[model samples]
Target: MTDDTIKEVLKRIPYGFYAITSRSGDDVNAMVANWVMQTSFSPRQVALGLEKVSYTYGLIEKGGVFAINIFLKDGADALKPFMKGRSKNPDKMKDIQYSEGPETGSPILESAAAYLECRVVRIVDTGGDHDTVIGGVVAAGVSSPGEVGDTLSLPDLGWSYAG
Candidate 1:
């Protein structure tokens, strides 16, 4: 297969935008991610792919937990700040209203349409730019009723994280 074919094939896979949040000591951080999927059903596991070098990855490793916040399509603009590789501001959570999740103590954004608190089960080195972190869902909640199917997807933001 050619390079174009590879890119096109990867791009064809559907993805939903999510905010992956982690905390270390008193510090917390959130990053925009699309490579998140449910890997198991019986134990309720989730796999999140994050760049190995990202600050959020370090936090997850150190904290042993994380929270995934799903946003609505209408709130796509609110997630732009998280897309940045690094923030000049010391407190990235300052601009947003969020509360610590009871399960993992990770910041759960109030703006999220739904949220899931997870405990890190294991980390798999993908031997690439990213690593797969498996998490066990401990807690989850939806902000409002009837918000299902209104989540922000990659196409909704005109963004592509695939090759």
Candidate 2:
């Protein structure tokens, strides 16, 4: 298989869109991420493919906590503020409205339909540009009830992150 073929196949894999928030002391950041999913049932763990150099990655490493803010399809606008990387938009979290999660102290966006607060269980080197962050869900909440179909996804925004 060729590189193009591999990218095409990987892009076809469906992904949910989410705002991943992290904090360390006074440093807080949020970024738009799609490479997140549940990894275990017994321990209620979730894996997030986080870029090694991302601001949130550093925060998570120091704070040992993070939050996945799940939005509805109509809440795409709320994620726009976090689309740009911290290097480009240093004050991205300034205008956003959120409250600290109970267990992790991670920011839970008000726009999120639901959220999962997680404590870092491990960070595994994937031998790629991104590292796999396994977090155990320590707390969760739903502000707006909805089905899976109502959740926001990459396709909903005509975007692709996998290759």
Candidate 3:
């Protein structure tokens, strides 16, 4: 297949957008992430693909915890500030309203449709642009009180993050 065809095919795969938060000491950061998946049903584990250079990755490595904030389909605009890499913008989480997850101490987005706090089980070198970090869910909850629409997805936002 042509390169463009491969990209289009990859884009066709359904993927949800999330605000992944990690903390180290007093530092906390959030980033727009699209490569996360539930890996195990028994233990309720999740695997997140994070670039090696990501500031949040560094925090997750050190803190051994993170939180996945599932955004609402109609709240994509609220997540725009976190779409930038924290390496370029150190204060990415500044002025954003969030609360510390009781289980992992990771920042949970106040406006997310749902939130999952996880404790890192391990990280594997993917030999790609991103490393695979596996985590076990410790706590989870729904942020919104009323009925919520579908979680935000790449196609819903007309965005592309993977090849």
RMSD of each: 1.4, 0.7, 1.6
lDDT of each: 0.89, 0.96, 0.88
| Backbone clash count for every predicted candidate, in the order shown | 0, 0, 0
- Answer with 2 or 3, whichever has the higher TM-score: 2
Q: Write the per-residue lDDT of candidate 1 for residues 24-107, one digit (tens) a residue.
A: 899899889999999999899999988998999899999999999998888787787787755454566778889999988999
What local lDDT score does residue 113 receive in model 2, on the 0 to 100 scale?
A: 97
Residue 35's C-alpha lDDT in candidate 1?
96
List model 2 lDDT by residue over 23-70, tens digit each.
Answer: 999889999999999999989999999999898999999999999999
Model 2 steric clash total: 0
Give me the candidate number with maximum lDDT: 2
**Candidate number that wins on TM-score, 1 or 2:** 2
Clashing pairs in model 3, backbone N/Cα/C closer than 3 A: none
Deviation (Å) of 113 in candidate 1: 0.8
TM-score of 1: 0.94
List the candidates ranked by lDDT, beginning with the highest.
2, 1, 3
